[model samples]
Target chain A: EPEVTQTPSHQVTQMGQEVILRCVPISNHLYFYWYRQILGQKVEFLVSFYNNEISEKSEIFDDQFSVERPDGSNFTLKIRSTKLEDSAMYFCASSERDYGYEQYFGPGTRLTVT
Target chain B: AQTVTQSQPEMSVQEAETVTLSCTYDTSESNYYLFWYKQPPSRQMILVIRQEAYKQQNATENRFSVNFQKAAKSFSLKISDSQLGDTAMYFCAFVASNTGNQFYFGTGTSLTVIP
Candidate 1:
């Protein structure tokens, strides 16, 4: 079965440095999302994208965060400046439709900021 | 806003036995989706099962099944014939049907299948 895939399974960056996490969602999927889970914490929603635009976002998705669908298959989350709290497992998910359908998740990229 | 709660921080089951993980949520929207996801040691989030709020019948996927109580706002996962591979952190999630596809996940229940 086709699945969402993310690049740079693990990322280590210095504090205040910019970093981009990349994802290649399922080819036919129309909606994409980004979520993060700090170690030992619940996964928190970051943002959702459809038609190459943001549909909704959470408070944690502040100015430092931005998402882009630079290409047909690539969906990326860029952090303008990484904070220690930004270190977490970031997941990318996609769904074929917008409503009630199960969204498939990627393996996740572990971001570690020192 | 929706919140998913998994009260049990940790649970264990002997190999070949059965285990049930509890989950409850707070949501005003009548139509939504509930899900169970497994995050193994590799940290890959895998969808285990899903239940549509409109469905009266609980959803089942092989050994994995759900006891969804829409009225009570409770959704629990039951794993039958538990195996070592079943050991992982299980998260209960909720998504509103009519709005953006953002998932609200619980703190997670770490399940250990002991041999």
Candidate 2:
């Protein structure tokens, strides 16, 4: 089965530095999403994208966060200035229309802002 | 806003036994989807099963099945013939059909399958 793929399984960056997490959603998927999970915490929704625009976002998705579908398959999340509290496991997910709400998740990128 | 609640923080089931993880959600949307996701040590959350609110019959996938009560706003997962591989943190999630599929997830219940 086709699955979402993310690059740089682990990222370590200094505070205030800019970092981008890349994800290649499964081909043919129209909707894409990004979720974050602090260690031992529940996963929190960050943002959702469709038609090259954001559909909805959570309060945690503040000024520092931005998402882009630079290419047909590549969807990325960019943090303008990292903070220590931003360290968490970021997941990229996609679901085809016919599959209903079933989302295929990427293994996740562990971003550590030190 | 919707909220999913997993009252059980941790549960254990002996190998080859059966276990049930409790989940209850509060949602006003009449049409929605409920799910149970398994997060192993790898940190990737995998879909274990799903239940549509409109369906009266429960949803089942292999050893994983759900007892969904629409009126009570409850959705619980039951794992039969549990194995070591079933050990993971299970999260109960809710998504409204019209809400762009942004899930409201519970804190999660860590399930350990003892051998």
lDDT of 1: 0.93
TM-score of each: 0.95, 0.94
> What are the DockQ scores of the candidates, in order?
0.78, 0.58
Candidate 1 clashing pairs, residues 3+ apart or interchain: none
Classify candidate 2 by CAPRI docking class. Answer: medium
State the displacement of the C-alpha of residue B17, model 2, in Å, after optimal TM-score superposition: 0.5
Model 2 chain B weakest lDDT span, ten residues long: B95-104
Worst 10 residues of 1 chain A by lDDT: A95-104
In model 2, what is the error at residue A50, expressed in angstroms?
Answer: 1.2
Best by TM-score: 1
